[model samples]
Target: MLVPTAAGTPAAPAGSPADTAPSVSASTAVAQARSTEVEEQLARDPGRFRVLTGDRPTGALHLGHLLATLDNRVRLQDAGVDVVLVVADYQVITDRDDAGDLPAVVREVVLDYLAAGIDPARSTVFTHSAVPALNQLLLPFLSLVSVAELERNPTVKAEAVDAERRQGRGMSGLLFTYPVHQAADILFCRANLVPVGQDQLPHLETTRTVARRFNQRYAPTTGYFPEPEALLTPSLTVLGDDGAKMSKSRGNALELRASEDETVRFFRRARTDSERHITYEPERRPEVANLLRIGAHLAGTTPGELADAVGAAGAGRLKTVVTEAVVEGLRPLRERRAALAADGPAVVRDVLARGNARANEIADRTLADVRELMGTMYS
Candidate 1:
């Protein structure tokens, strides 16, 4: 049996209808409606929504994180939504065998979060391993999905290829089922809103599928899980100094934790066209526009305005403006981060402890509900 959910997708039985695999255009239209609805609801009653979003601790966060999602995470939290930030430590090994500097990287991630204004009091910041019950939800979630559906996920396919390339071996089973793990993360808290970029819509779709199927099969009347809606990020993609997506591994990223001198050095080596006339034409002049966008973000103005302000000054003057903006804008965060770093791991440990405690509480309750619904509450 199948029923249409509020999101306009049919809640067919798992693997049935092949999900009817709506065409890209159809799915995008549905997603657009949901996004609009979510925004409207947020404007009226933001507190009613819970947001789940995070990053892996595989690398330090960079400018892209700031412009894309971290800033918005703070905005949503301040707007009274319950924000749950997960440091996906377990996922670090999905591709690589050893993240040898796990402790250091996790600490760095926490530091970045704190520095980025993710108040530990307002948000729950937890790691994956600390809450075993969360991962336990995976088994049931996995059952609600299928191998073919997992294979069909474009994000999974891309990551799997990248993983194999990095490891020089076939993708791991964990990598194949990564979207399901992400589903567990979302539904564990029953988060109804997830902030994501365009490329991540497919992963969010998988979460919605598992949530819908689980409710239909296990708790039809109750609708135990929310079909999470994507709060599509409005920020433009922050490109690298080299005109591509900012990436730390590629050495094109300007990390949030970088020293002022480092920031200057990065822009110093940045690529820009020879045109002395400055303008914010991302499509035609991506290199120059990348710098302008970054500057505009820091200066609290539009890229075009920044460009006009620097009109005829050329790339040299533009880089200097951006460099100064970055340094001055990041000053307070750097100070806060330095203070946090000085306390050793005390602050990080405390944040994780509180966050993990709350996560376990929520996860246990959700797990119990699932067991009761499935008639598996043996205890």
Candidate 2:
């Protein structure tokens, strides 16, 4: 769902059916209502700190991924979190069948970050392929870590089972070894904070374990790895037109690149129950529940307020309110994307160049420490 935060931005799709306008019970029907005020407030706060978060460019970022990597990124950046967008191009090859597309995919992800308003100046963004030292850390760390330990990691098991279901076999070594590499990604830069949804806590825990293990093995007295901490996101956003947890493989995801018409069409067709009365019972009314959730999120009002307005309203009335909220929510984002896309592909390249250099700089420090400790050739 588009979260409209820009002012004077057109929210309702121009082609939206006339009847889909917000009803009296619903507020903020501006379709393109400005809501960045909240983020602006957070940005002005002095206490907000830095963050390192990103994605592996396995596919185009759908709405689900955007909320994590882009929307939350914009909010945190505004909240003064020093953000680093990581393009895990190397991780895409974890299970193979995608080695050739990594470069373009990296550029594509970088563009998405830029389009999403991640200011390169406020945040440093980098690609995994560019940081050879970071990747090298994975090898030695893997030796310190054991196969049995890897198997126990939650993300590993989840992906392994998922891969097995889809490919009729378990995911490969890269997929299996991904958790350790992730540990390196966080620890190499000495990142102290990662923003993560609740379900992703386990993934971040692995980073914590690795930091503890490495510090115990090498710097037990002084401590290294920083034992990165989690911001522990309060809520999660769902995707897929079906209102299920959005995923690329599910074919239910809406891409950031989707057009206004596409966005409208996508939401209009989203799965909702046949029971006409629009209510905000998440457990009871998943379809209407999804719409209510989107509306509440965008309107900055509690879901209870939405349910009150929607009380006894049939599906048609509920659709009008939800559609309006969604349209208003996305309009500013569309404008921002249009402006950023005009900057052209070269912009992404420069961000990558600068980010990669910064990453190498950090990775070099860790690599140096480890080499000296192990009495390597360079040391």
Candidate 3:
């Protein structure tokens, strides 16, 4: 039997409602519902299922993040979709006004992805520096999304207002305009699906908005910018040990590259209450509940099963179990990374070559359509 979590606690994980499978017929009755669910989950895109997603090269990816981006990237590739992972090396300047680690950061970030099972051959992972035309598309998109619109953007507001309130460098124009670059990233390749977290819906919304407006204004009225649909990830909002958002800058992230020693230390410092038992109750036992959740995820069992396995050990032992599970879980990543980083420069170059070739072929067609719509078509 599952040990009781603290009383009155909720069971919903982030991005997951209490509802899992709704009571509905899987026959004719559910066809519309299923279709809508799919369209809502993915854009009812008639074009290719190419998925475009990228990261700002500010830091390394953590396990909490791997549960979202890296894993999803691999899944989309297996489904026969063209997947492009963009290394937003240019946008690093938005958060910090420095160029100190630009090349090093890009190199490290690429190696981290390779280590994390982001295959360069099966999927195209390339740095922004390698693709110049992508940035060029930004000029047009910038003209579409207004400053007021960008200001109202929840992400920019969170970064600039909420974060800057703590006395860091305030948000810059580049950060506010990062979405334009993102639109360029997707539309440059005419991507059809973009996988992202819930928080970035506004950014993706802006991407779609830019595509619509740009195609209306510049592309063939039939459209050049494929209004990219979002492939909403199932899990998001993975909490830090502190019970807040997970981020490297917040000092709240545990990197995928963390040594076993490092993983053990981080989990040990994770906050918990005076409650003496281990439970999966998130509402009442949020801190400990999150630990159990992560452990369940890495250990390949339900929280209920893990609770039973760690039976009666309470929070201290639960932490130990989670710590060990994470270390073992990430060992493959560490080893694969070591092998790749030995020839890191070559690996990055090859990824870029493949991505550029694929991206350019699509970009050329999209641009031609844009010129035709804008009446600049070279007859």
Model 2 lDDT-worst window of ten: 2-11
Q: What alpha-carbon RMSD in Å does predicted model 3 have with respect to the real structure?
A: 10.2
TM-score of 3: 0.81
lDDT of candidate 1 over 250-305, digit per residue (tens):
87898899999999998998889989999999889988888898888888999999
Q: Estimate, for each residue in 1-379, the C-alpha lDDT of model 3 and write its tens digit.
A: 1111111223233223222222323322333333345444433332246778888888778877787688677666665667888887887787776767676777777888777767777777777776666776777678877888787777787787665676746677778787777788887877767776455666766776776666545532244555655555654556776768778778898888777888888898888778776777777877877777788877788877787777677788988999988888788888888788787588776767887676666666766666666677667
Those runs of model 3 whose alpha carbons end farther than 4 Å from true positions after fitting are 1-36, 39-47, 159-170, 219-221, 241-243, 377-379
**Alpha-carbon RMSD to native, per candidate:** 3.2, 13.7, 10.2
Which one wins on TM-score?
A: 1
Which residue pairs overlap in candidate 2's backbone? 3-329, 4-329, 11-31, 11-32, 31-328, 32-328, 43-78, 50-82, 240-252
Clashing pairs in 1: none
The residue-by-residue lDDT of candidate 2 on 1-379, one tens digit each, is: 2221121222232234421323332312221121233234344652344467788787767666654556777877776776777888878777767476676776667776776778888788998888999999988778766787788777788886788678456688888988888888877877766766555665666676666566655664555556555655545567468777778768887777778687778777788887866667777776777667766766778777887898787777776777777667767766776776688778778888888898899899888987775668551
RMSD, candidate 2, Å: 13.7
- What TM-score would every model get versus the actual structure? 0.93, 0.81, 0.81
Better of 2 and 3 by lDDT: 3
The clash count of every prediction, one per candidate, is: 0, 9, 0
Model 2's TM-score against the true structure? 0.81
The list of candidate 2 runs beyond 4 A from truth reads 1-49, 162-170, 235-237, 377-379
